[model samples]
Target chain A: MPHDHHDHPHALLPPEPALRVKALETILCDKGLIDPAALEEIIDTYQNKIGPQNGARVVAKAWMDPDFKRALLQDATEVVRDLGYYGRQGEHMVVVENTAEQHNMVVCTLCSCYPWPLLGIPPGWYKSDAYRARAVREPRKVLAEFGVTLPPDTSVRVWDSTAEVRYLVLPMRPEGTEGWTEDQLVALVSRDSMIGTGLALAAASVIEGVEASNQSVEGTAE
Target chain B: MSRVHDMGGRFGDGAVLPEPQDGPVFATEWHARALAVTLACGSLGQWNIDTSRHARERLSPKDYSRFSYYEKWISALADLLVETGVLTLEDLEQAAERAKDQAGGSEEIQKSHPLSSRRLLPEQVAAVLAKGGPADRQEGPVARFQPGQKVRTRRLSDSALVNGGHTRLPNYAAGAVGHIERYHGNHVLPDSAAHGLGEAPEPLYAVRFAASELWAHPEHPGDQVVLDLWQSYLLPEEVA
Candidate 1:
């Protein structure tokens, strides 16, 4: 049997893992196996370029344009690529649409395989053991934890992404956003909404969220 | 082999925590470096993404659960570096010693180590990222089952688990009956791909299993779980 490292005294310490990573990176760099600058470039791409905002933009555009939505639903890979959010885990894309009678959720039961190009890095909880196990078994309970309460009559569909093909849930467009521009609609879209764990925030709720965040930032600044 | 990493339906871990409204891409610098090293080394073409994932999954269950997400990445990175002959164990040990020495003193270690056999040019990174790894093979055997066909996942024996070969089929879905939602076209099978057993491209499908059918007592009768399953993992329901 393999030794259990979890029993180590420092396993719970956050700095220890970081230190180990630094040590390995230093060694890899010293051995010329990895380029630190290239690593930074990759990080920048994921952090700045590839993210939920891109997916939000896609969702917002889909909401405004019926043709794009149809194209996205028919062939997401081509549509997403045309929009420049095509790479890595997003080579093969499938957009599941949420309707009045059905809702969709995504989970990678085996590992944390996600559409990185669309939603950026998955949130920490998405990779948790509990979510991976429960999302497929008890999706409604999982969605409830995310504060996404659906009507009892609506059926929930859980997508377990077990292959190279990735999925992005096209959440239903919220009400009271008539004639909204794509840019304005982007504010209502959140990363969780795209993952199907939560629904798109209402137009007014989005404003309230922004104001709340701004107030918190000001409080921190003060 | 069945492992904790293959987490589907088994429970008792803990509650899922909510994510921060707006979290940074990476919480710490090391996390970013870990991602970079994984991607940089991955660009070397030594091993594919599926193989890298198997390396991480092959970690002992205790370590798998204990390590932070990035920690798992670094561990797998080190393993792959040695496995691919990009770096020797001695080279890694020497690097570790150098890191330790730098930590304790002002001694400057020479940054003159020989480069790996393969290196991706900075200019190639964007194109490579944009192109991505499309698993679909141009030519392969015809798909065995079509959409709307009823099928059952093949059951694995205990010996199969003991042998410890990597497989894309999750254990929980094994032997369960589901309807073929759609044929996803020919794609490289990860079970064989992870072990250097050739691409072994085969037909894949979106198999839709009702939540009630998958679990003994499902939370909701209306719930459904769709898994992208490889053809090799399934058989005709009548034959199963």
Candidate 2:
């Protein structure tokens, strides 16, 4: 309420959710159950300190190191925690690698149970009602919406996160980047690929330059 | 039977529309605050993630379908605070009233809160994040299902559904036969843990079901949906 507004945000209507949330914060803070400073720190930690970049690093390392990849596939909790990405929602980790024969995807039918230590807070779509419903029913169609179309012969394996074990998909590394460094390959990884909606960016596709080219593949920049 | 939140294979929700992948993680400040407060309260040790999840599943279908992500979270969080004895309904109403205005009420309310000093300080954030609340328990009952074994999921009784008990079993896979893919050792069972019955750690398995068996018409016939199911929900599928 301290911030004055004449109502012009989100179709000129009141941001009731925002106001109600503020009220809830006030109540919790007044009751001494939560600290205002700690709240800010929590937001900052998720916003800047933790996110997809952590997962990108893990994936890049997995793609580069065979032993590490084996470690990740066999036991992601120990391997991922070794890289310092360990926390709630990702306490028990499982990495499913996408291969030529099988394409892996994940969804939490009951709720959005994502690997937070590596991926941070899930995006809006991951928690959408549409996604929670249809992802399991028709994952191929859902993947198509994300601009990813697998071959007819490829098996679309959809992992519904139902238990404590969280998942991170190790998307197959893009071709034509034979000797790229870990940091360079990190840029090729998008958030969706780890969740199994899209693939890693094409090595020479876009981002640094979005100029029209015949090689502009799906999941390339933007 | 299923609660409103368990929407696995059920269709008709329409197309998936995600915000741009490169966009900001959170849309608004309130959403951020909502998330932060939830984490802070969660760190208080009074409740676990399953308890918070059960709060949402118990919501009426109308509210579950209508409320936005954070709206559902905030509502559930409020009920948790009261249920855990951290605050009362009156306490929430009064604070919400104060939030409506920047007047002198907040200063007085803070002084009156008996547990005020027990707040999670900024310095503790790093340690808390590092040492998260892990659900895995080393010791539990022996494994009942092994990999490659055919198992069928048992449905929840109508009473379990009506009573609003918490369970990890989704409705879509109910009574569906699947092959055990892997054994995930023992972990805290959400069903008993959510209601303060006990952690009741049990053996878990990843059961893989063919799309054909789960859906009347799967878009991709060869596709598979794998679910991590607790042993209690599974029964040995005798060869027929």
Best by DockQ: 1
Count backbone overlaps in model 1. 0
The sequence of per-residue lDDT tens digits that candidate 2 reaches over residues B65-140 is 9889987887777767777777766666565566667573556565445555667898999788878878878888
Q: After superposition, how far is residue A4 of candidate 1 from its true place, in Å?
A: 11
Clashing pairs in 1: none
TM-score of model 2 (CA atoms): 0.91
Q: After superposition, how far is residue A43 of candidate 1 from its true place, in Å?
A: 1.3
Poorest lDDT segment (10 consecutive residues) of candidate 2 chain A: A4-13
> lDDT of all predictions, in order shown?
0.81, 0.83
Q: Give the lowest summed-lDDT range of ten residues in model 1 chain A.
A: A5-14
DockQ for all models: 0.50, 0.44
lDDT of 1 by residue, B67-128 (tens): 87888887776777677767666655565555556664524555554455455556667777
